[model samples]
Target: MNKATYQQQFTTEDSPGWLAIDDQLDQIYGDTEPRHYPPLCGLHYAAGGSDPIDGASIYDSNHQEFHRHIVSYGLSELYYDEEKAGGEFSKWGFELTFRLLPFQDDQHDPIWAIQIMNNLARYVFTSGKWFEENHFVPANGPIRLDTETEITGFVFALDPELGKIQTPHGEVSFLQMVGITNTEVEKLKQNPTTDAVKELIDHLKKDNPLLITDLNRK
Candidate 1:
């Protein structure tokens, strides 16, 4: 179909990119329902709120390890738009994904991770810079504010499972967040190379494929 014709018929219901991402999540969750959290006020660019995106949390429990997976819904062209639709890469090219180790007795997904994702979204929206694989950023303090967690920063990596997908908007990459301690963050700041981040992730993956953020890492 011609671009004009396609855009005319496009509606939020016809958001292929959004649907494709949900489908991928459905495949992973199967019959389980993920806990979804939409921004209470609205997106930052529009409403000037703290959170600029929607978040969904899913729990994965197996013999090997158990963790909570959180994914964001803003970072890309989520809906159908002629002007921003169809390109070599999705809106900003990637969506943020995070895996956190869940406490055995935990009853609900940690809201802190969602806040972290929103802050990152704020940085991108305000700075016009996008995050990519191997890119790292300092949290400036404890990743979980007011908490004594050793995780002080994060690095981006292609999600080992979700990886990337072709959407109507373009190529969307699932950039997973890997927590890094103060020492590791310093190493990344000093080197700032893709290989340096890769090595750190490789070391992390030796324990878990999801690369769950270990807050207590010393």
Candidate 2:
């Protein structure tokens, strides 16, 4: 099981902010590869070691793929907000990176990448039901990525042989015993009522009206 690495770069177009970034869709550089560029490029990641996604096209449109990056919505701190630069400026927000480890069939995406994308989904679903089964609920309580500038720009390298990931900055030991899977979620399901599971479900179901609308299921 391999994990994918993603990097987010937040910028503010005013005062020459993000002078080093662009809004292109085909240019980026980091220790690894991003499956696609920004603006809801048809796919995104999610919590747990799940599969890559075909992002809904209602809200974001991969408008500026270059300036778009990854981050944990639950952890993202920055967001764009300005009146003069129109609504497309990349200012007033911090960049984020998500690392979805690589696997045999699917590619890697950054962690928290799903959360960020889901927020986008909420805005898209505002007008109607999603997939005809799940209704849209505006995303809220999302994590911000602004305060993590110091560590958000760093990278982690994989050491398959040593069963760990090493970076010029630091390292994380990969426990081969579990073999990398989303079992964490499955395990959580066993107890149907744990606080941790409820929190996780709440976060995952933020945009899912079908889940939240129910008062008995939870």
Candidate 3:
């Protein structure tokens, strides 16, 4: 479809890209809708108003361990013809996803992951740096503030299940966040190669395919 046609035929049901993302989540959760969160104060670029993208959180128990999966909208071409829609990579080419292990009795969804997503978005907008598979970045401290957890950095990887989808805009990949400790980050820096990061992730996935960030790992 051309840009004008795409713009005219863009309802949520008719939205190929956006609906595909929702459908992927639906297949996994089966009739369960995620708890969607919109930012309280708008992101810096939105002129202190409403947020451009919405965050969705879903609790998954089927995996060997239970964790909350948070997904971000708006990183890519969520709406039809919002921008040119033909390229190998979608608008930003990827959406940010985070999987966090939850406390057994915890009832409320953790909002920290949403904050991290927004911060990453801000960095992209300001710095023009895009994160891709096998890229590692330092969190500078515990991923969770004021906590003593050893996880101090994050590595990106294609989500095992929600790998990639062809959208009206192009191709979008779901880049998941896997936390690592200072020691692991240093080891990765010494090598500075994609294989080095992949090896570390491969080791982590052996125990947990979802690659849940283990704050207690030594």
Candidate 4:
């Protein structure tokens, strides 16, 4: 949006950025009430809770196959701050996303993915670091503790379906975190470049366009 239009629109709205995000999700999910996890108090992270992300929304997706699609809020300027009107990018310019293959246990949900996003958000908020497309992070152990899985790390890419959107606050990219094996992490470390990571993602995308994180994959 243009400078004048953006200012006129967002200035009056209580949470234009938040609404914009919801609208984008609406296009895809269409009234599907996602399983949302928010803090007990207001602005959980700011109010001193473990989750830095304001909220985490998980939806059952069947784009390529059955999976859980998780998206994070609060990584960007979710609420209206008059001072931050229409810049090049949002707060961190991106929100974390994760696509995981459905777990076996029907009794439990995939809250672990939410925790991982919060941990990453904490790192960004505390250390002033940010992630971009094709970035990789090591988990030190299996991504899901106590689980026998080869996925020990993560590599980020633009969420295949969500991609990116322009909000009244700024632009936000849905950066999806895909699970990877320790072996893949080692390969990324050897090169440490965006292209190298892209090469890895491209190969994975051939069969899995959405790059869903299958914990059982070796």
- Give model 2 RMSD, 1 decimal: 18.1
Computed on alpha carbons, the lDDT of every model, listed in order, comes to 0.78, 0.26, 0.76, 0.86
Off by over 4 Å in 4: 1-13, 40-43
Clashes of each: 0, 33, 0, 0
Instruction: Kindly report which residue stretches of model 2 are placed more than 4 angstroms away from their true locations once superposed.
Output: 1-36, 40-97, 106-120, 123-182, 190-218
Best by lDDT: 4
Structure candidate 3, residue pairs in collision = none
Tens-digit lDDT string for candidate 4 (1-218): 56677667765557777787788889899988899888524457877787788988889887889888999888988876766777778899999899998767434668888889988998999999899998988899999988888999999999998889988768999999999998998888889788999999999999999999998898
lDDT of 3 by residue, 1-218 (tens): 45666667675456566676887777778887678776647452345544445555555645767677888876776654546655567778898888888743336777776777877877876787888999988888888787777888899999887899877678899999898988998888798688989998898899889887666666
lDDT agreement of model 2 with the native: 0.26
TM-score of each: 0.87, 0.24, 0.87, 0.92
What would you estimate as the lDDT of candidate 4? 0.86
Q: Output the number of the TM-score-best candidate.
A: 4
lDDT for 51 in candidate 1 is: 70
Q: 1 or 3: which has the higher lDDT?
A: 1
Ranking by TM-score: 4, 1, 3, 2
RMSD of 3: 2.8
